[model samples]
Every structure is written in C-alpha cells, then in structure tokens.
Target: MLDTYFNFLQNIERTLGGGRGVKYGLPSTLQKVIALFRVDAAEIRLNQPILAELRLPSQFGDFNRITSETPYTEAVITGAEGHLGTLVLYGSRQWSDNELRVVHLIAQQLGVALENATYFAQMKLKTSELKWIDKFGDSLLNMLSSLQIQEVAGRIMSATKDLLEVEEASIMLKDYESGDLMLWSHTPPEKDLSIRLKPGQGIAGWVVEYGKTAIVNDVKKDPRWEPAIDEKGGFDTRSIIAVPIILDDEIIGVIEGINKVNDIFDESDAQLLRTIAKWSAIGVGNANTYEALKHTTEQLADAKKQTAMAHMVLNLAHKINNSVGAVRVWAMEMADELKATPHPSMEMRLMVENVLHNAEETLLMVRRIRGATELRPGDIRPIEVIEAMETALQFSRVDAAVKVERHYEDGIPRVGADAERLVEVFLHLMNNATDVMNGRGTLTLTCRRAQNGTVEIMIQDDGQGIPDHLRSKIFDPFVTSKSDGLGLGLWMVKLYVELIGGKISVTSTVGKGTIFRITLPPWEK
Candidate 1:
C-alpha cells in the first residue's frame, strides 16, 4: 500500500508537470487514484457545468452517482469555490485509517487542481468572448458604414446573436409614439416570430423600461420573464441576458441573448452585450429614425394615390347621381300618369313604382359615397356611442367562440365625432380583433372619462397580439399582419378617429392580447 501511494504521487507529479492544461489532468488524476485504491469503478461529477467522467472500462461502467442517494462511497471535492464536484468510488472492503487518509489526501489534491482548472477555463472563455466582441465591433463599424438603414438594422441583430453564440437572440425597439417594445429583429433568421412587448411587460420589456442589465441563468426563476414569448418563438428559454440600448439618456430598445448554446449566461456575456449595445446605440437610433421616416414617406405616397382615386370616383359618382336624379323624376311622372288611369293594369303600376324605388336607392348610394369621402363631425353622446358600437358588432358578426365584454362608466363623457365614421372605425377594429383571436377569446370594450375629462374608449381582445414589426405600422396602410388583408382597416380607423377630433393608439403582447385605446374631445350639451 505504501508503494502504491508512492506510485500515485509520482503519477500526479508527472500529470502536473505534463503542462497539457486541466483537461487531461482530471481524468489522469482519477486513473492514478483508482490504480492506487484498486477500486472496481470511479467517477468525478463536476458541480458548476454538470460534467462527468465518461464511462470507459477503466474509469466507470454502471453505478449511481449523486451527492446523496447513492450506494457508493462519496468523496466531496472541495475547492476554493465551495464544492467543486463529487468523486464516487466502489471498493470491495471498508478502508483502513491509512487508506481513508489517502482518499482524503487524493480528494484534497483534486480539489486544488479543479479550482485551478475552473479558473483557467474561465480565462479561456474570456479570451474567446473577447474575440467575438472584437468581431462584433468590426461588424458594427461595417453596419455604420452602410447607407441602408434596414441592412444596418439586420446586421446589428446577426452580430449580437453571433457575439454570444446563443441558440436564439432578439432585438426589441421601443416606439416612443406608443411606449411599446417592438421586435426589431430575431435569429435564427428563418424563425421570424414577430414579437411585441408592452412597456414593462416581460424580461426584455423590464430591461427596456428600467434601463437595466438582466443576466438570468434560469428564466424560470426570474419574475420578469414571460414564458409566453417562448411559446411564440417555439423554443424553451432556459436562460437569458438582456441589456437596454440607451441613446441620449433614453432607452431606445433592448438586446437579448437567449439560451446559451452550451452554458448559462454570466457577467462576461452581459459585458459583451452591454458593450455592443453601448457602441451600437447611435446606429440603432439612426436606423429607427430612418425607418420611421421611410414609413411616413411610403404612407404619404399611398395617401396621395388614394386621394387621387377618390377624386376620380367622386366625379363619377356625381355624374351617376345626376343621371339617377333624372330617372327618378321620369319615374315619378310615369307613376303619376299611371295613377291617373283608374283602370290601369296592376302589373304596369307596380313596374312604375319599382323604377322609382331603384332610382331613389341609386341616388342615396351616390350621396353616401360623397359623405364617406368627407369628414362630417357631429354630436356623439353615450347613446350614439353605444349604437355605433352595437351596429359595428352586428356588422362584424364575430364568431360565437368570441366573448364580448362592454363597460360603460356613469360619467362617460360625450364627444363630437362623425357618427357614421365612428361605426366604420369600430367595425374595422373589431374585425381585426376577431382575426387575431382566431375566432376565439374575449373582446372587451370600455368607455369612461379620462383624467383630463376626455372620453376614453378601449377595444381589447385576448388573442395572438400584433407583431412588433407591424404594431407601430398598424395605422399605416399596406402594413397588415394578416395573410389575407388589405392592411387598410387600422389605417382607416386612425384616419377616421383623427379627422373626428380624437386620438387612437394600441398596445399588444405576443400570444397574450392587444388593446386599442381611443380618446375623443369632450363636448358639453
């Protein structure tokens, strides 16, 4: 036994002197210990990363391993950083005092070696992370050099994702117009699960709202995490690190690395993310500004085209109205002539009346077209509000699976708005809500007095909420989330609302729900 101890010490010295780093040191030390003790099997299970020795014939085969609930003798591997791992051994007989002392000494040696290994591994990781950081810095510079704002935005997303080599990454930009977080970009590029977070809604939302760095090794343990995002993204979020993109003392957005490929997120990862965010803030800010301007330019072009089309249609409508007016006068005269003949055939009289009715309907439709092209604001009291909403619901004809909720406060302020346009706005908004809910979920409508004495109205639905990319553009024409939509519903809704001396805005969360708020200028009777 004393000779075996000498051999083990000599082998350990050779392993330490080999200078092959800690990878071979651990298993080699275990092999030497096994040979000295003559154990049937041996294993070393790490604590931090949960790594364990492979089941080679010489190392281990079949044995339960744990700090507790295992049959084998357990040797605690203690290091400077608390317990490093556990060394389980299977020996045929109980150890003598000398043997036990030898085991303890081996474990102590292993602990020191493991502590050194852990530190070395960390340094290596830092070196690798620094390389990634350097790459990201170069990518940011390239992105900044690009004149295309959209391309720059996309590169920022890919660079951040590659910086940490995480399974998934996302960038959520805040809409200062609505105070909502919009998913700016996501990777893997194929999984374009457009996500949106209401202010202070989820982990990313929390980071953006508070302008803080969040490094969560386990999302399940964090209160700020919203698991619904995982369902939307189609992944299990084990860990996350989120950092805010601040510009000019304002949190413009949040950048996140989710589910590290092989490890949990740590300060080094956070530091890299923070560094990227700090350097890319100007780029992100400029990109967003350019996007907003581009979107507005497109909207103006669309609006101009629509205006020209409406002008031409209005002219045609006027011609149709004049022709129909002449027809109605002729029909009236014919009806009068038919009435004068007491013995006229009933069929002939009926024909004359039908012509008059058709002419009158045509004229009414032409007038309606004119009315729709113009904003005609009028008194909109609670009665008109209820009627318009009910009429809209009737028009939309939501599925039976959709539940409706209506709340009207006692002092619901009366506002001035075009009554007909109001119904159209509600109709379009409700139709959108129905589509998002997939014919199921609850639709809530509320009308009350706001703090500023204005009438506040809300149309809410528990549904698959709007995507972040399209959320800010909900009121912009040709920006629809639906696979089969003209994308003009919310655009019309906004147009009508604003034209009627009111304001409309929306807030949404992916898979949770959405709410559209409307405020109208109060009008006293």
Candidate 2:
C-alpha cells in the first residue's frame, strides 16, 4: 500500500505540469485520498496558514487519538531521515484492524512522496525562472538597440510582472532634488498590479532611498505600507517586493511587484527583479540624458536664430531709414516748389499730393514692420474678435471688392493672446482668401467658444479649396502655390499664432473652399 500510494503522488506531479503545476496538482489527488479515507474533505497545508481544504475530520477513522473537540486526528510521519512530516485523520468510528494498518502504511509513504514532489516543484520553478530570465535578456537587448527610454521602462515593468508572476508591477523614478519618487510606468492591474509610492514612504521609496531591495511578505501587516491609494484604486494589497534601480552608485528608481501568485516572493524573484532594476536604470539614465541634450541643442539653435534675426533687422532698419529720409526730403521739396509758384499747374499739385501720400505710407509700413519684429512672448491682450477682424479687413482695403461677413458670439470672453500677432494671423488668412477669390468671393470670420475654454476663430473662404496634398504644406516656410506669394506670410502667421500659445488647423476639400481655425485660450474678463 505504501508503494502504491507513493506512485500515486509521483503520478500527480506529472499530471499537473506547466503553469497549473503549483495550484491544481496536490489538492486534486489529496481529494481522492480523502474519499479513500471516507472523509468529507482533505487538505495538504504546507508551512501552516495555507489551508487547502476544510471539513469535519470525523469521517476518516484513521487516527488513533483525538486531542481537540474538532474530532480531528493528526500524525507526524518521518521520511528516510526523520524529516518534517504531517498526517491528520478524523472519523466517527474506529476502522477495522486491517484498515488501520493500511492507513499507517500509506501515511509513511505519503511523507516521502510529498518531500520528493516538493523538491521536484522547486526544480521546475527554477527552470521556469531561467527561461524567463533568458527571454527578458533578449527583450532587453532589443529595447537597448532602439534607445527608447519610456519604451524600455514599460517593457521592464511588464517583464518584471511576468517573471515574478505577481498580480501587478510598477517602476517609480526618484527625484533626487525633491526627494520624491514619481510613478513612471506600470503593468496595469489587469496585466499585473497597480501601486503608487512616494519617496521615503512606501516600499518603493524605501528601496530607492536606501538603494537596496525590500521585501514585504504581507503588505496588510506592514506599517510602512500606506492606505493612501486604496480609496482611489479600490483594491487591497497583500504583499510587495521592491528593488532599487541603481546606476553608477546613484539611485535612479525602484521596480516593484505586488501579490505573489502562490506565496511570498523568494530568492528567484529577488534575483530577476534586481536584474530588471539594473537594466531599467540604464534605460532611464539614457532617456534623461537624451532629453537634456535635446533641450540644450534647441536653446543653442534658438539663440543663434535670434542673433541672425537681430542682424537682419538692424540692416533692414538702416536701409529703410535712408530710403524714408530721401522720400521725406523729396516730398518737402515738392511742397516748397508748389508754394513758391504763383499757380502751380494742376498736374504739379496732383504730383506733390501723391508724393506726400506715398511718404506717409512708407513710414507707416516701417513702423508696422518694427512692431511685428519687436513683439515677444507672454504679451497678450483682450481685443474684441469682431473689432480685430474689421481692422484687418479695412487695412487690406478689400471690404468693397470682397463680401466680408463677421459672425461674433455675443458676450464672448476675450482671448489671452498678443493683439498684433492675432491681427497678423487674421490678415494672413484673409489675404490668402482674397487672393484665392481674385478679390471677389465671400470671406467669413466667425468666432465662438471652444470646448476647452479657448476661443475659436474661423476664417473661411468661398474660393477654390486647397488641394488635399497641398494643404499640409500651406503653412510651411517658403512653400506656396501662388506665383507671386512670398510664402513667408503664412509661415510668419503660424509662428505668431504658436508664439501666443494658440493652435491653427486647416480643413479643406477641393471645390468646396477652405476654413482656417485658430484656437486661443480665453482671458479672464
């Protein structure tokens, strides 16, 4: 009977292979054994507190003594070397003498078989861990090849959850200056676990602060764990294991796993978690460095562009100044000659009037150029949308030729944007529409409130719509469909719109006209 029972335990391990080996293997065979013993239920409780089954033990009839009122019988049977063992039986009546002998025989062999099965399980677990590590190593290599920090961190969290076989996993980054740990990435609760930790607070923070791994076998009992996130997440935590992500002696982040599948996390989980932490640290460091370099490069480029623009502006101002001075002198000379003559011919008077008008226009043009160039970021004002549109249309001198329609929402709040830039934006759009219409089509300027508390300004044209392929490049610098277009008009308009924290988008279909929408944050009225 002992040999037969040993064989039954051995076969049970083989029956429950793969991921189910740890869960479905023992309880099932143990149930059959309970039936054989005529007990209502049977269980194999390993290391206490892990109860697999529960029932009144009075039906088995396999115990010689009953010590507790529960009427359960428990025995300790040793293996080849007196190893720790457990066998419990309960029943209503004593078994037959032969049956009792068979029970003892089965108990003795059960101890040896359970020991072997447990050892086999440990080996299989180790093998599965190795396979996981290999897969993780391959994935790490691929992520490294791409040099994407967030993607690598995301993958690391995912791998940590899978390798640790936990309910959830997350990676938290440490801010050394603020001493705060921020949640970076995580395998969501559905995939693994969901947890958030602050610096020097939860397991993740403690690991980051100390630059070491910390294991909490039961999170519910750990005082270091907080209930801060429980209200929002609506889930109770059971266990946690956090490993510090360190790179070059600097603590960067923490990788954490929550709720092990069968039991508390062991050495294998610690080992894999540490490995992932190390690689994730490297990936995070690379990402930070890349971002820093990118920011620096952008600053340098902007500085250089500003320097070049300053030089161009100075040169342009010098040329304009000289030309304006010469035109002013010519206009004064013509006025003087008109006054000196007794009756300056009608043609001469008309010529002098034209000269004065052209001089005033040139000076105004110079002033407008200077104003456009001098405006900077953060200079915003509240200009009525209808008023700005009317001003731009009047300046364009197309109100007579083109049908200018203004649709302004009453009580619309003002927009926090530079008035000059906004005018330029409207002017560009209106000018482009006028050109498209050959100065004869209807141009509508509509204003309304946007979904995000921003003001939406739409400038629609009734002329031929932009081609689908050309719409994308319409705002690009030096890309224009018009033969006489400077191309910088729309480009400058886009720059000013974006500079004032506004967004511009165009939607057009062939033969249906085009609409340009500009959205700007509404100002406090």
Candidate 3:
C-alpha cells in the first residue's frame, strides 16, 4: 500500500505540469491504485453519478462475477462535513489492517475531489438560471408594454415550458362572473379541449383555493388528481407543479407545469414556478390597470365635449332669439296696418297675415331651443299628461299629410314634473316624429299608469325607424341621422328627463317604425 501511494504521487507530479490543470482524472487514479494493491475487483459509487466508474485489471474477472458471496472491504468517503459516497474493494481473502488503512486514505481524497466537482456543477446551474430569469423578466416587460393580455398569457406559458423543460404548461384564470377556473392559455395548444375547474376541484384549483404551491411527483398517487381532464383529452399526467399567481395579496390565478421532462417534479422546480408566477401576476395587473385608465380618459373627453356643445347651443339660441324677436314685432305691426287700411287688396292682406304667422312661429322655435339648451331649474308640480300632450301638439308644426292618433287611459295618475319643461320635451319628440314620417305615416301618442308608480307616455311613429348602428348612441350629444338636424333634440330630452327624476328609452326597427317611452314619477297627491 505504501509503495502504491508513492507511485500515485509521482504520477500526479508528472501530470500536473502537462498544462491540463488538476484533471484529477479520478477514475484512472483509482484504477492504478486498485491494480497496484492487486485487489480482485473494485468499484466507487457516489450519491449521484458525478464521474465514470474505475476498475482494476481482471484475471479473477468482472465485479458482477465476484457477487455478494465474495468478501469485500467498504469505506464511506466522508467529506469535511458529510458522506460523499462509498468505496468498496472486493477479493476472496479478508482485507488486512494495512489494506483497510490505505482504503480509508483513498476514500478521503475522493471525497474532497467529488465535493469540489459538485460545487462547480451547481454554480454553473445557478448562473444559467439567473440568466434565464433576467431574460424572462425583460420579455414580460415588453409584453405588458403592448397591453395585449392574451398575448402576454401565451408568452408566459411558452416561457414556463422552456424554463422548466416541461412537456406541457397552462395558465388558468378565475372567471369573474362564473367563478370557475378557466384555462386561459396553454402551450402546444389543445383546440378541442375546453377545461373549467371549480374552486377546490382539481390540482390547479386547489392551489388557487388554498393559496399555496403544489408539487405532485406522481399524479396517480395524489388524491387531488383529477382524471377526467386526462381522459377527455387523451393526455397522461405523470407529474405536476402548480403555483398561485398572487396580486395584492389575493390569488388571481394558477400556473401549472405538467409532466416535467424525463424527471419528477421537485422543490427546486416548484420554486422556479413560483418565481415565474410572481412576474406573471405583475404583468396581468399592470395590463388591467392600463385598460381601465384608458376607458376613464375616453369618458372624461366625452364629458368635456358635451359641456362645450351645451355652451355653443345656448349662445346660438340667444343670438337667434334677438334677431327673430325684432322680425316678429315688425311683422305684427305690418299685419295690423294692412288690416286697418280701407279697401286693401285681398292679396296684400293674405301675404301680411302669412308673414306675421311665420315670424311668430320662428320666435317660438327660438324659445324652445333656448329652454332645451339652458337646462335651467324650473317650477316642479303635478302635471296632467293629457294637458301637456295637447300643448305640445298645438305648438308642433306637423305636416298636413301626416295622421295623428291619441290614446289616453282614463284615471291615469298625473306625473311630477316641470310643466313647461315637460311641454318642451313632448314638443321636441313630436317634431322628430313628424320629420321621420315624411308627411305620410301615422304618429300615435299613448299615456298610461306604469306598475312602478310612474306615468308612462309612449310616442310611436310609423316612419323609417333608426338604423341599428345608430340606435345605441342616438341620445348622445352631437349624434343625429338627419342632414338638417342639430342632433341636440334627443340629447336635451334625455338630460331633461333625467333631471326631473324620469327615464326615457326608445325601441326602433329599421324600415319599420320607432316608439319612445318616457316614465315619470307619479304625483303623490
């Protein structure tokens, strides 16, 4: 044994300066030592396979041939702190004290060499993991910048599969309305599968329900394994790791990797998945917040536009009223002078009367526009629906060819409203109905008591109804289907109805007709 040690040291000295640098070449060194000791056979085993096996020359033949029946001496290679592996030497004779001591020395040297190699390998793995994490984080940031939620989710699933070397990965999000776990994205997409899990129903659901990570090395052995999914999709799940995606201390979803490639899932894989889930949560939250902010900004812009439009309407109404009032006074004076003249021609009399009537009508229109645009606070009182309808029809400029029908229910309750404003609302609606009918169709006005303690008045027109695309936004400011309309009539009607604690809705069918329903609170007294 002593001579063998000397020869081993000489071999190391010769190989050290060969510039290959401490290539302990442990297997070769062990083989040389075994041959020098003349052991029948020898073998080295590590807790994990760190290097190739070493063997002595065989006249007695292979290690397997020696078998368990053969006598052997074994020494555990203990590192500075832990057992690295075991070293066993087999022979037909019992190992003597000297040979045992030599084996112990060799074991110690092997332990140190194996420990260093293990550390180097682990360091390399950690460096690679760090680089992967950095690249993944950068990619997520870019995805979130685009604010495409589904695209981000798909990329996350792909990155998870690559990072963990998994055969399949999926992202499951909680459906806000259904309260079910929905498969939002998956790698190697399954077009025919529609998977949904309730809370506490499956592995992914369990993670989300309990807000913890799950690592199942063998799905067949786990009670939480749900086989229905596998059976439905013809998929076999051998192992799985699921982690909750938490945001604001709440679990929003779960990310799962299935059947880790060529191996069972372990704590290290679970930890990696948890790290990825954290980044995914952040990306999802940011994207949702960005979408919300964008919607709010659009709403604010619309409100500003409506405010500016209202001011313009008020200014125009005032300017036109001033001009029209002067013309109304001049026409009235001219009509009076023509009537007072004796023997005046009938043509002059008829023309003067027409001018006076037109001037009065123009002044009335200016007043209605002013009332609708100004939105001024007015007297509120019990208003009889029939009386208000009569006033509106009296002021309306309906075409002579159009037919008008009125149906008033007896004993209907009066509505609580500003009589003057309500009159203006009805007048605008009647005018709109007339314009749509194009001087030929029927305009029907009906009044009744609604079940909800309100007065319901419906104005139905058998004119070409509003188009489908324009119906939804018909009441919004500056939206109109008319070439000569200001688009403010319906908007003002909506604003006035809402201000008076009423609701208005319209049902229209293109090329058929339209019905506008207005409901107002019934007068208590």
Candidate 4:
C-alpha cells in the first residue's frame, strides 16, 4: 500500500502543471487518484479567493461533484495564502484513518503545485508590465532628447492610457497666457484641441495649485472633481491619478489619468506618473532652450554660428547618448533573458531583437546629427567604382540614353578607408552626376594608382557643369547650387574624404562639364 502511495505521489509530481495533476498538469493525476485509492469517485472543489483557475474541478463521467451535503471523506487543499480548495473521496466502504492521511497528503501536494504555478504566472505578468514601462521611459527620453517637444505631450498622454490601463488621459500645461490650465494632450482627441480650465478649478488644477500628486479612486466622492471638462469632452470620470510636472521647484503642467480601465487608481500608477512628469519638464525646458539658442545662432556670423551649432549638437548628442545607452542595455538584457528562457514566445523574441536594432540605428543617427563621423578604418582594397557603377546602373534603368564608362588600372593599390563611408562618398557623387546629365550625356568613373603611394578616383559628368563661383564654396555646409538641394552632399563628401586621410577636389564649367577627383592614402604596414 505504501508502494502504491509512492507511485501515486510520483505521478502527481510528474504531471504537476501538465498531465492529470489537476487539469493544471494534474488533471489526469486526479483521475489516476481514483484508481490508486480504489475509490468509486473523487472531486476537487474550489474554495473562496480564486487565484487563477475558475472552472469547477472535474468529477469524471457520471460521478457527482462534491457538495455541502455529500457524505464523503475530505482533504482540505491549502496554499501559502491559506485555504485554496478541497479534495473529496467517495467509496463503497468505510475508510480508515491512515487512508485519510494519505488522501490529505496528495491533496496538499496538488495545492502546493497549483500555488507555485500561479506565482510563476503572476511573475510573467509583472515582467511584461515592467518591460513595457521601461520601453515607455526610453521612448519619452528619446523624444525629449531630440527636441521633438510638440509631439511629446500627445504621445505621453496616449501611452499613459495603456501604462495605467485608463480611459481618457490628458496633459495640461499651466497657461500663463490666460492664468489657467490649458489641456495640451488628450486621448481620443477632441475636435476642439485647445481647452482651458480656470485657475485651481479641477483635480489637475488642484495638483498644480497645491504642487502635489493626486490619487482619486472615485471622482464622484471627491469635492475637487470637475465635471465641466468631462461634460465638454463627452467623457465620464470615475477614478483619477494626476501628477504635477515640476521643474526647479515650479509646477509647469499636470498629467491626469481618468478612469482606470480595470481597477481603480493606486499609488503605483501615481508613482509612474510622477517619474514621467519629471521627464516631461526636462523635455519642455530643452525645447525652449534649444529654440532660443537656434535663434541666437542664426543671428551670428557664419563662422561663429557653425562652431556654436556644432558645440550645441555635440552636447545634445552626449546627453542623448547616455539615455540611448540605457535603452540599449534594456534591449540587450531582454534578449539574453528571452534566449535563456525555455520556449519563449516568438513575438517577444522578435520584439526584443527589433528594439536592439532600433537602438543601434538611433545611436548611429544621433552621432550623425552631432556631425561626429565614426569610422572603422581597414585595409580596403583598391577603390571600387562599383558603388558609383551600381548607381549609374540603376539610373541606366530609367534612361538608356545616358552612357556610363568605368575605367580601372590593373595595379591600383589598396587604400586605408572606412569602406561603408567610402561607398557613400561615391554614391553621392554619382547621384549628382546622373542628376546633372539629365538623361542624355556621359558619366565617367575612373580608378587607378596615384604616383604618391595613394589611390586616385574620379567622377566626370558631361551635362551642365558647376559655376566657378560656386565651386569654391561647394564643400561648405548648405552651399548647394541646386534649387532644391539642402547642399550637405558635397560638404559630406569633403568631410568623409578628409576624415579618412584623403583629399577631394573639383573643376567644373557653367555649360561644359565637371570632374570630381579624390585621392586616398595606401594602407599602413
């Protein structure tokens, strides 16, 4: 009989969350319990405070489920929190005291197993919540760091709805213009975008007026509840969590979340809003300061303005880089965790991978914006006009009239260069050549060894050439002759050339043609 008990116990352990353990793994384990005990029937009845499972326990075919009046042996099932459910056994004969203990032992293990499973499930849910919240923080920081202040409020309000599981959230900035609070961001956005509130009038106003966070579970019971805004916006107010956006001891705005979608407002939601509010303040201030500096820079002479702008951008990039690093760490940790986990969801893995890719891309873009050209110098083979050829090839698809000629000398030396940037240099020049030719001229690409232990390349175009006056300033930032050009192309080409220890020059005529010559040093020993 003890052996039989051990086998049954082992069976329960085997199917703890899976097999017959309880329809949890124990669903079949419970059915096996009947056979092991030689009982006619058995049932597990759920008690108060359902942690996860909601369905009534199976009683098998034609067997009655346990009830208050049923005469049967009982084994109470309990978890860490206390009584979770009950296990009942029905038989043809009287049961002994020893048998009852074994029955209780089995029931106890089932309860413990179910409880463990519940906690694991809860942990996954919390992990998911934390993941999104971290991502939300990253999103907000990136927006603020980029000076995209105009879009930040709406995004914060909309995202807070999902973060707090709420319906109808808004960000309200204290309006000095009208001595009131103006609704800056609204979810399920209203047709009338700008709505104002009187000073200290509503819950949001009260937060700003008092310089504190507000957590209102029931707006109906709070005297500070303002129904006018709800009536005007055609939204209902149930629960509220509003936080003040403070900067340097001054409250600038309010973030109000109205009516939680599931449960009422809690301290956790208030705390999240508080953190977000601080970030929002930084965002607002950065946008204002950036604009002011931009205006001032515009007023300065060209040389001074370029130097000042470069400094400003590099500083902004440094700040943003630190924030972006945090995002990257989160992504990397998420990826490692996903990989370590057994049977991780495909969607989650893909999402983490996508985040990592985006973080790397954004980092590169930030560096680019700072005018910081990162390089990976290597022993690159002789200049491949392949990139320019590819561009010409692509252009050839559109117009068969344009002729492309590629010339390469057999003994060209390998150059030290960042190959990717080198490709960009050629692509940009080739694109210009194709554009100028206007579909009916010659685009020549040449690559050869130079006399001075260097590699030489040239892109010559036979359609409308650059004016001599413009050629001198052609490599200067924003100095484009094209009517629609931002003028950064030639500047970038010059920058890229110089960065890799190379040189670029150009000669052109107004009506004849243009040739861009580039020389790159040979790879070091």
TM agreement with the true structure for every prediction: 0.51, 0.41, 0.41, 0.32
lDDT of each: 0.70, 0.64, 0.73, 0.69
TM-score for candidate 1:
0.51
User: Predicted candidate 1: what Cα RMSD to the true structure?
Assistant: 28.5
Rate residue 253 of model 4 by lDDT: 86
Q: What is candidate 1's lDDT per residue for 1-525, written digit by digit as tens?
A: 454554565466457432223465656677666666666568766666524222222245334433343446667776533576777787565677556655655665565555444433444455566776445545545444432466766777777777787877777888765788998777777776778789999988889777889999888988888989888878888988999988778788998888898888888888888876865675554444435433543444455556665576678789999898998999898888888987989999899889988998778767655654565344344345766788889989587899999898785645666666678778878887898788988999888777777778889999988888878767765677767775545665676677667889999999899999998877656
Candidate 3, backbone clash total? 0
Model 4: residues >4 Å from true position, as ranges? Answer: 1-136, 297-525
Per-residue lDDT of 176 in model 1: 65
Q: Which residue pairs of candidate 2 clash? A: 57-90, 58-91, 58-92, 167-192, 167-193, 168-192, 168-193
- Residue 307, model 4: lDDT of 58
Alpha carbon lDDT at 17, candidate 2: 35
Q: lDDT per residue, candidate 3, 1-525, as tens digits?
A: 344454454463243221122244554666666676676777776675555322212122266668668887788875433576788877766666656665666665555445444433444455566875555554433333333467667778877888888998988989875779998888678556789999898899899999989999899999999999899777888999999998768788999999989888888788779877876775576446434433543444465557677778778777877887887788788878877888888988788788778877777766766655444544567888889998998999776787888899899887777788898899989988998888688989999876666889999999999998889899876689988776877988987787778899999998889999999888776
Task: Go through the candidates in order and give the clash count of each.
Answer: 0, 7, 0, 13
**Is 2 or 3 the stronger prediction by lDDT?**
3
lDDT of model 3 at residue 399?
Answer: 67
Candidate 2 lDDT over 39-93, as tens digits, reads 5443333442222221212223333343445454455543323434466655555
C-alpha lDDT of residue 157 in model 2: 68
Which 10-residue span in candidate 1 carries the lowest summed lDDT? 50-59
Order of all candidates by lDDT, from best down to worst?
3, 1, 4, 2
